[model samples]
Target: MAESPKRDTRDTTPDPKGRTQDRLIEHSYDGIQEYDNPMPRWWLTTFALTIIFSVLYVLNIGPIGAGKGWIADYEADMKAFAAAHPAPSGNDVSEGALLALVGDQKALAAGKSTFDAYCASCHRQDGGGLIGPSLVDNYWLHGGKITDIYKTVVDGVLAKGMPPWGKSLKPEQLTAVVAYVVSMHGSNPPNPKAPQGELVTP
Candidate 1:
């Protein structure tokens, strides 16, 4: 019979606290000892889960996490919202209806308020020309028709100093303003500024 080689045996088991009872000892020259302790099952499991979750989120390959993720979703939502709430149409006010507002005292008052708030800096409170041409005079740089006035108020003349008041004022407010301007015809102010532009029919 051949001689059997000697084998070293060591017990490896868990303690009551679930920690490994047998620690692997590392050799050191100065007698300072080091042992290898297995990480707790719960901690290892949690660390693995975290790594997996981070990979899934960062890769953007999964169904729910695809594309730009939350940012893409936010953009889609905002675009949908804008499509739902469109801007007011110019057709909301008719030329005939807008013309009717000229005699309306309440409408005129509203128009006057808007004009004072916005137009007074250029046109003056009395409709006499300041930086802008006289609103009271028959002469109009732009045409004098209700449609012409509407376009001017909405789009504005950048070459001149006037800004588009339609953006700041509501459609109804703009209609009222046009009415007030129409009502100003033929009533000359005391110190009327020099007349400018060709005369046109309202």
Candidate 2:
């Protein structure tokens, strides 16, 4: 008996689903085949829109004006804020201004708290000299004037082992702490360490 030849199974025209199965012959692996399918209309439209949006965004055109990027807007806002709230001035940190705060019990308390947190380790809790110089004594490593104290606290005497507090403390806090140190004068705490600098009246 004669055997019949097998017919080819590959489609040569568009399928019922509208896929051009004839021209879409992808490489076969094992016994499986693939079709070169077209993407959905909605997906293609979205992809094109995204590309357009990227170009527009980079160019800053149409609805997006030039120099209107997020970073530019942020910088503008920061500049305006800085202009509105300027940095503190010398008068703001003056001795008289700080002394006035001494009269405010609240300010003294705040200053004491700040000193304890930062200065107490070296100066001791009672303002008696330890690793750092005493605040209660008439003598000072630096000048004892209110302005001098303010500068010392802000600039710090690095050579003498004190770190500058200017960056760490706010303007008001610096003034308050200086005021508190001034208030401690003549307190004469126990175990008072020997004075190290010129005598200046409080």
Candidate 3:
């Protein structure tokens, strides 16, 4: 018996639309065959757009093509926020204001609550020092003046592991805590840490 003639699978012929007709691939397995069809125009366009977008994204380029990039954009946003809501500064509160709070029982109670929640872990409940220096002692690491203490609390000693509470705490809480610390001066809490800084008269 003669072998069957091979089927024509060439894609050279053009269709009525003047586009090459998709032809079946020559090889087949179990009588299964497939055509070499080009992807749809819309799909190809979408794929190309995705590639362009990926390149722009990798370069941190903004929508306008010419921009400061994502990092700069983020920094600008942060600066705007800071300008709109400035961090509490030492100058914002006066020493007399803080001293007045020191004598206020309600303010002192609030301060003690805040201190227990945030500061007790480092300074101990009695302000005798733990990881941080003693608050009850005459020696001051940053300063002894009430205003100086306010600055320290607002700015924080990052090198010494104290966080700037000005950003986290309310303005009232900051002043209250400072007042509470002032009241702790000369407290002579038991087992106080050795004086870390120069002695300052209370």
Predicted structure with the largest lDDT when compared to the true one: 3
Query: What's the TM for model 3?
Result: 0.60
Whose lDDT is higher: candidate 1's or candidate 3's?
Answer: 3
Better of 1 and 2 by lDDT: 2
Q: Write the per-residue lDDT of candidate 3 for residues 95-184, one digit (tens) a residue.
A: 777888999999999999999998999999999999999999889988899999988988889999999888799988988888898898
Worst 10 residues of 1 by lDDT: 2-11
Estimate, for each residue in 67-115, the C-alpha lDDT of model 1 and write its tens digit: 5665566788889976885434664567888888988999999999988
What are the TM-scores, per candidate, against the unseen true structure? 0.55, 0.55, 0.60
Clashing pairs in 2: none
Query: How do the candidates rank by lDDT, highest first?
Result: 3, 2, 1
In model 1, the clashing pairs are: none
Once fitted onto the true fold, the runs of candidate 1 whose alpha carbons sit more than 4 angstroms away are 1-87
What TM-score number comes out for model 1?
0.55
What's the lDDT for residue 193 in model 3? 85
lDDT of each: 0.78, 0.81, 0.86
